[model samples]
Target: MAMYAYKDAARTVKILARDAQKQDKSNRYYCPNHKCDAHMFIRNIEGVSASYFGAIHSHGHINNCPHGASNRFNPNDYDEDTFEFDNALLALTMPGMSQTKKELPGEHGSGNAKASPPRTIRQIYSMCKAHDCSDTYNGVKIGKMLLDNRSVYMYPKGVFGWRIIEAKCKRPHFYNSIKKEISLIASTAGEEYTFILKFESEKLFKEIKNVIFLNRECFTVVAGQWSSSGTFNVFCTTFLSKKQLAIIN
Candidate 1:
């Protein structure tokens, strides 16, 4: 089951099943994976608790698409160092900086090889969820962080890298188009915390706004440097990108 799907055939816009159900049924939906050409349809069972995008049996996902199967992620199935970062600092930078490097002439066949694709915020979030937030890869701790007074003391300068912030509120609490700011609530250990995310670019803000509007009850995995001023004053830095945010159920 997929939580998101492309709104159009061009796949530039994303739509969640909850919002898609309100749209005209004539509209077509595509696989969330851009690399896949599979067609999808909104699935809202009569007694199910949630709705999701399901792939049509006739138009299954491509062989390599991660969403092709519903199997749970098992870290033991792969090499322990599979998710290790080559350069932790570089990976914590902006999105474009973590792209795979091109291979030289003899690099393909020789011991030297091309770099692997950089991990996305969603991929890291998946690992955290699978391990219940106790797994650590390359010195980076993957776990839940409370948005309370203790968090401010722990990360005064803010958190760097991909981190999961469990949503406490079902919907966004605040939005400011002029300042490009959005505020949301997060929870850990039963305590709720609030944080504001300010987008530096209009393009990025619009993309995030679209997701927030569509999936009001989902949580977010944020990438970049997060800073806290007081117990309730937490926000992100300008070092963020569209790829740094993954809003999921």
Candidate 2:
């Protein structure tokens, strides 16, 4: 069973099982892992549990596919108190730049030099999903600044709609040439929250704009620091790359 699946044969777009229920059944679904060719179908047993994707009997996932091992996100595997921010697994700077190491909890010395390389946007998105978008853990460092949970906004549950808006630019022209903003609204039960993404790249902005324009309902995960002011409205002013944002519908 898997919580996510590719919505198209090209495997460029991913869709959550719960969200897939709203889509037409005629649409094809495939394994989220690009290496896996297993066909998937929605399984929504009315009273048992939430909707999810199940592999067809004749089509099985490949041995090397991560989904083949286990697609469920086990919360027990992650403890916020013990969770240490892995800079190598999370982008602090843009892609292609060398990732710096942050000192682990109760650890001395420069840092772990053998740590793995930074993860892709999809990998970071998967990690957030596995943790249910919890941000109560070791802080994430960008440059010389360390941002705690208070300054971070995880992927909110029940994201229903989003839109792009013009934002004021205050950064130096030589460093930041483009400025765009996207506001995502998520509502679940009786609660509502707006997550904002203020970026400086026309390419990233266009990518997000196209996804929202093409899909009726989509999910987005952004890795950045939240604005210091706001209750229901949370915004980020961090520079973003294509690898820092993950969009699925």
For model 2, what is the C-alpha lDDT against the true structure? 0.45
- Top lDDT: which candidate number? 1
Overall local distance difference test of candidate 1 = 0.52
Q: Candidate 1: give the clashing pairs.
A: 158-226
Tens digit of lDDT per residue, candidate 1, span 31-84? 756788877777665454345566778888887454554322323222325455
**Where in model 1 is the C-alpha error above 4 Å?**
1-72, 76-118, 144-162, 168-172, 188-190, 230-233
189 Cα displacement, candidate 1 (Å): 5.6
Rate residue 235 of model 1 by lDDT: 49
User: Considering summed lDDT, which 10 consecutive residues are worst modelled in model 2?
Assistant: 162-171
Candidate 2 lands at a TM-score of 0.40
**TM-score winner among the candidates?**
1
Model 2 residue runs over 4 Å out of place are 1-118, 131-179, 229-231
